[model samples]
Target: MNVQSNPVTASDTNARVLSYAEAIREAMAIAMQADPTVILMGEDIGVYGGAFQVTLDLIDRFGPERVMDTPISELGGAGVAVGAALTGLKPIFEFQFSDFAMLAMEQIVNQAAKLRYMLGGEAAVPVVFRMPSGSGTGAAAQHSQSIEAWFGHVPGLKVLQPSTPEDAKGMLLAALADPDPVMIFEHKLLYKTKGHVPEGSYLTPIGKALVRRTGSDLTIVAGSIMLHRALEAAEKLATDGINVEVIDLRSIRPIDRDTILTSVRKTGKLLVVYEGVKAYGVGAEISAMVAESDAFDYLDAPILRLGAADAPVPYNPDLERASVPQVDTIEAAARRLVRREV
Candidate 1:
């Protein structure tokens, strides 16, 4: 019954549930209304309503001038957005797919990430790159990939992967307000997932993680859709006398090391799960963070990571389902970690 999301305001007592995509669009609409400098640039976003239809009809309200669509050039579009941000306009650039962002690495990793520091804070690139990520929709390898780990490695770039609709909206608004460039990877399957979202503007802290569920036996860390799966697994494992703690790692780059360390210290067992490739993913980073910290002394068992198999996203539904950790797999991993260690 536990949903992983930040608490809403007192004024949001009557907050309504919105699909993750709708919440994102609402955030952009709010930002655009409040700040004339806010603009959106992406291919097929205007008339076509974006590749996933997340930007549907924004052009009708903001008009083509503000919600202008770009050509199928990720590098060129990203360059323009970065350039726009340099000149003081807030541009939210949406990549058609997370995979396409690699084509603009020079702009994202080299230019946008370093300009503020390289210019000695003389310029701020308040650009938000919205990427529809993950591989649940049968888009296959080319269109489906969870490569947040790639840019998460890039310094000076803030990377966020929100699991809930509330976070999806709040985090986007927060990124728009930040001076540094932020990348938000929206899992494709989460677009239709709904959750309560507060009316009006708000911000979810970028670098913090939320302890979704508390337990004393084990800690399961996950983000994006994986967070939801972790929560489900935790609930099921509770019936088997294996209580598992779950942490929603909202931000990938600036991980909430303190929360993770504290949980591992309490639980003494860690299971890191992600939708990315199993080897050298964010799970490894968390494992290393715990292993290198004082939390290592508290661990009753060796830390384990559960992520996608070492292969491209499969197009077949059943194979795709097997490619990544699911509720059953997560439950099994948690049970194994707890029973074997605790």
Candidate 2:
């Protein structure tokens, strides 16, 4: 089944529509086929097909050596992946749940992030860490946190949060190509979302943002699932004469400040939305970027940020829905901003 109604064309051929998970698997397959040094290491990624089944059937294609499954210890697997990267192997490590990444902080934050800098740029750590992140699956507090901001805060590591199947496939390839360590936070709810994806290898440049919709009144900057909701909000606002511009922040770290500033400068108002908590989160940094730049002069309203409440995600579906910004909430916020009510 084609997931995208309007598939992007690559050259003269129409691109295939694929789900986010399928796109990611295709990217890994393409990379592994092209490079012998490329390897995949994660718990149950081989025989069990990974926790999310994103790595299903890879073991049969690449065999046990390249698609090696490790013990359930995230710390051990992450450390070994870093070691392999340091030794000239391109390793893609998958964490069952992003929350498990917290267990591997020492290796990711210290060793993976600082090794090249410590060695005077003499070595390259070409490692990609992929994990299922975000709330909406009733996974409760421990597993549903949107913690991309935590890694984005680090200097040397590059953090990505792709919102579409196309971006998911492209960004994964780009992450593998990078010389430094890259963290890819895949939202659990978005795994089934479909979009047009190219058949072969393609790189969606890191540190760039995509403008999902353009308008002249207010600009909405969002990442991951929030971007999708922002687009839906934009569509809803259009019927009421609120032309909202929506920017998809595909990459969290090294954010595309230029795109954001340009959009804000055009719209004269900015609303930053994220699934992460509002306090000191990704939106805070984005709001600061605009405030500190020349874009501040163009803002007709006080910059607003809509994010999840500063608390652990609850398991109850209704409570979970209330905790994070939804399409209606975004629409309400945009209307308030446009009407000069807030």
Global lDDT scores for all candidate models:
0.91, 0.90
Q: Would you list the clashing residue pairs of candidate 1?
A: none
Q: Which pairs of residues collide in model 2?
A: none
Please give each candidate's TM-score: 0.97, 0.97
Supply the global lDDT for candidate 2. 0.90
Give the TM-score comparing model 1 with the true structure, all chains together: 0.97
RMSD of 2: 1.9
Give candidate 2 regions above 4 Å deviation: 1-13
> For model 1, what is the alpha-carbon lDDT of residue 325?
95
